[model samples]
Target: MKNLMKVIDALLDGLKRVLVRFREAKLGLLFIINIFKIPDFISDKRVNIINKFRLIFALTIAIIYIVSGIDFIPEIIVGIFGFIDDMFVLVWSLGIVNEEIEKYKKIIKKNKDPKIIEDVDFHIRD
Candidate 1:
């Protein structure tokens, strides 16, 4: 029936939106946790010089922009509305820092226990 089809379509759309929101919430939570780890990551020498430099520079700029009055959106006139740009830069930079930290962690893990060739059945290619 037409009514049944409409109901099915509505349900699917609602479900899709819910799934998207859930995914966003999950990523937000991860971002919050990783944001705190920025300091540790920056201090970690194993993260490689390039990654460390990038993380430090990104964080410095974000912090400065958030705290200084010379932002693209001045909070003085717009009140809390000004924080939009500050939050955007902070979140964006923190996201990059988190990604770098994750990459370094993965690299460290892989190097620590490399599974190059261990305990596997082998077959000669014919």
Candidate 2:
């Protein structure tokens, strides 16, 4: 078991080195980070609605591109490895939507269970 783990670690080290050598990996990493940052954009009250709409539009386009075979010729020629990107995009979008829904639920809960306190002392005596 120890030997197997050692081999796996060696393989990962080599893979990491190769991935760093490839410049596209950094761009892909950034894309992944941006995808996860969707909730931040949604939660930020300071951000413009138009900017948020644009972000959603871009994500929709990315999903369309992944689902359609026109953007990537590999899907046209190689049938077996094609569904990977489609599945990835689907899961990513679902994850973002789920997170936003949870955040909204939290906001609603806070509103429903109000514990208001005013600085001027909101006290009423009959």
Which candidate number would show the highest lDDT if scored against the true structure?
Answer: 1
Residue pairs with clashing backbones, model 2: none
Supply every candidate's count of residue pairs whose N, Cα or C atoms clash at under 3 angstroms. Answer: 0, 0
Tens-digit lDDT track for model 1 on 58-126? 788988887787987788899999887776676566666666767776876766545477789989998
TM-score for each candidate, following the candidate numbering = 0.58, 0.41
**Which ten contiguous residues of candidate 2 have the minimum total lDDT?**
18-27
How far off is model 2, as Cα RMSD? 11.7
Q: Which residue ranges in model 2 land beyond 4 Å of their true spot?
A: 1-55, 71-73, 113-126
